[model samples]
Target: MDRIRIGLVGIGKIARDQHLPALNQGGDFDLAATASRNGRVDGVEAHETVDALIAARPDIAAISLCTPPAGRFEQAMAAIAAGRHVMLEKPPAATVSEAEALAEAARAKGVTLFATWHSREAAEVDAARGWLADKAIRAVRIMWREDIRQWHPGQDWILAPGGFGVFDPGINALSIATRILPDPLVVLSAELAIPENRACPIAATIAMRCGTAPVAVDFDFLQTGDQTWDIEVDTDAGTLYLRNGGSRLELPGAEPMQGPNAEYPRLYARFAELIRNGESDVDLRPLRLVADAFLTGQPTPAPAFEF
Candidate 1:
């Protein structure tokens, strides 16, 4: 099959770090063009807007959007309307309604739409899922904390109302959790700690319930040491731990499981498959959980944060 000609919409940190590397490794796609206000990938035709890129690069078959959620809906719709497949970064859109609209539009246009969840592709996630398939889950806990300054320096969109704040990384944990858990879950209670000077929360404590199993998720941006991205589950058989964001899995009387670091590469491969198969992969479960937390969760004022 001929390689797909691809364009990148947002060339921010994630696009540069994860998406570009993944696309290069996939080898099924050619980086035909890119559109960004301030960032650009080497050797690719650059445009300041998606519209211009689409208008100029008629050979492009798909576009990957890596922008913030605030303005993603329009860009995605435009791309789909122009007869191109779209791969959206996590938190598909600012609101569920917008994401639904994008899905519907993609259906009408007969193009593939992928809501990419890189964490779900982590090395140990599939192994952990296989182990937990038969175990009776009693409870689940997720502790994800990191310093914003170190991870997201100078990224103002994260602090904006639609930016999702700590839920940015928090959504990653949710993605892995929803993928591994055996039962459907919903948010029961939540407390968001918003920094006094920002519109979004810097920390959040969420309580979720799935059938009889209770789950607790803690996301914070104030950690100083040993950043944690770990999920633990207590089952009737034994305790299961997925540390390092599903990169490492541990169980009683079992050696740790590890795999190749090719999340982006794998994602692009899946995208190619979906495009060839004429199907769409749009899982809103993870983003739905985050929106529910924002809508139904309680709010707590936190100390001012400066980065």
Candidate 2:
């Protein structure tokens, strides 16, 4: 199989830390080019804009767009128009409608458009999903807290209007919940703790109606010690837990089982498979829930956060 020539857009921290390393090591992709205003990858052709990348690297078969969700729709449409497959980062677009439109356009253009949920590809997540396939979940609890300064660093866009803030990481939990649950989830209510100085919420307590049961998600960006990303479910059979970002799973009566930390590698492989099979993978349930929270959630003021 010919390796897919990929152009990476938005070469920020994630591109350097996760995407670049995964692409370089994966056998299915070649880092043919990069498009970023200030960031560049060594040994790869760099362009300041996607237009230049499309014109200069005609051999590029696919583009992995890691840009922020705000302007993703236009760039994704551009890629599809150029006859290239697109793999979007999480929260495919700022709005679910935009993601749906992109999917429709991709189908019209007959190109593969992959919306990635990296956390969904974890081995343990797959196992948990299989376990809960037949069981009934009574409730779910999610605690996803991390130090934004440590995770996002100097990225100012995270606090922008389109930026999700705590929901940025919180969406990962929602993605997993939506996938593992047997029934659909709807946002029931939410409390957003906005910093006086920032545009987005710094902490949040979200409630959801997962099927008949209530699911609660607690998210905080100011957590300092032992950054946690954990989810626990109370089911008819027993309790199921995914701690340490879905890398570990615990069941009712069994020993704790650990899974591989290969989310990015598996994600890239899935992208390749979609391109090879001539299909698009676009799931917006997670993003939709976030959008709903914004529409229906009540604002709760918190102390001003200083970066």
Candidate 3:
């Protein structure tokens, strides 16, 4: 089969670090063009905007949108309307309603639409799910802490109203939790700690319930020591620990299992498969949990944060 010509929009950190490398390594996709205001990819035609890229590169069959969630809807809609398959970064859109709109547009145009959740494809996620398939889940705890200034730098969109704030990384945990847990869950309580200087929250504490099972998620940006992205589960069988953002898994008596670090590669492979099979993989459960936390969670003022 001929390689799918792909265009990339929003050449930010993720685009350079993950998307570009992944697409370059994947055999099913060829990076044909890119769109960005201040970033560019070597050896590819670059445009000032996604619209220009779409208009200029007619051969591009798919467009991977790496822009922040705030302005994802319009760009995604345009790509779908132009008959290009779309692969959206996590949190799909600024709002749940916008994501729904994009889904509708993709269906109307009969094109493949993939809402990419890189964390969901983490090496140990599937293993965690498999292990928990028959075991009774008693509780889940997540601790996702990182230095935003070191990670995001001057990216201002992450602090915007629809930027998702701490939920940006928090949603990844939610994605893994929702996928691995045996039963359906819903947000029971939440506390958002918004930086006084920013429009989005910098920290959040969320409590979720899956029937009788309870889950707690904590997202913090003040960690100065060894950055942590870990999830623990207390089950009737034993304790399960997923560390390094699902890269490694450890159960009661077993040693830590290491897995491949190819989330983006796997994502592109899935996208290619979806395109070839004429299917859409648009799961909104993770995004829904974030929205629920925003809608019903209490807001708390937090110390000023600088980047």
Candidate 4:
């Protein structure tokens, strides 16, 4: 089959690091064009805006948006309006309503809309989910911590009002939890540690529930030393652990399962399948859980953070 020509927007760090490499690998997609304000891929058509890319490359069948969540709704809507399949990065949009509207618009335009959670497509997430399917979950602990300076660099928007802050990475944990666990999760309470100089939290502690099991979450964006992105679950059968952001899994009676992180590749493959099958996959459970935490979280002041 001929590869589908696709345009990518927001050529930032993630685009350069993950999306470009994944798209370049053998897949159902060809990186036909890119739209970005300050970044570009060598030997590829580049445009300054999504509208320009769409106008210039009318044959591009799909558009993948890796832009920041704050202003992604407009770009996605524009792509959907042009009858192009759209794939969104995690969190989908800055707000739930915006994501919902994009989904509705895509459906109305009869194009595929895929809201991708890259972590949920990690090497062992499905295995973790399968193991917990028949077992009784007792408790879940999510500890996701990373240094913003190392990962995000000078991205000040991360601490801005619509940036999502620590939840940006924390939601990855929730995505895996919501996928692997059998029942829905509800946010009970959250303690958001906001930097004195920022609008969003630098760290957070959340209490949640899933089928009567307590789910505790700790999210930190200023963590130094070894970074942690792990989820542990206590079950009637035994304990299940997902390490390296779902790239590895450890179960009670089985040997450890480890694999290279192939999340973006899987995501692109899934996006292609969705477009070919005339389907849309937009799971909002993780986003909703974050929203609920914000709705009920109590804010506390922390020391000013600077990158």
Highest lDDT: give the candidate number. 4
* Cα-based lDDT for every prediction: 0.91, 0.90, 0.91, 0.94
After superposition, the stretches of candidate 4 with alpha carbons farther than 4 Å from their true spots are none
Q: How many backbone clashes does candidate 1 have?
A: 0
User: What's the TM for model 1?
Assistant: 0.98
lDDT of 4 by residue, 3-115 (tens): 89999999998898899999999799999999999999999999999999999999999999999999999999999999999999888999999999998998899999999
lDDT by residue (3-63, candidate 3, tens digit) is 9999999999999889988987867999999999999888889999999999998999999
Pairs of residues at least 3 apart in sequence or in different chains that clash in candidate 4: none
Q: Candidate 2 vs. truth: CA RMSD?
A: 1.0
Cα deviation at 27, candidate 3, in Å, is: 1.7
Better of 2 and 3 by lDDT: 3
For all predicted structures, in order, the TM-scores are 0.98, 0.98, 0.98, 0.99
The digit string of per-residue lDDT tens for model 1 on 128-211 reads: 898899999999999999988888888988988899999999999999988999998799889999988999999999999866
User: What TM-score, to 2 decimals, does candidate 4 have?
Assistant: 0.99
The candidate 1 region of ten consecutive residues with least summed lDDT is 257-266
- lDDT for 260 in candidate 1 is 72
Q: Is candidate 1 or candidate 3 better by lDDT?
A: 1
Candidate 1 lDDT score at position 137? 95
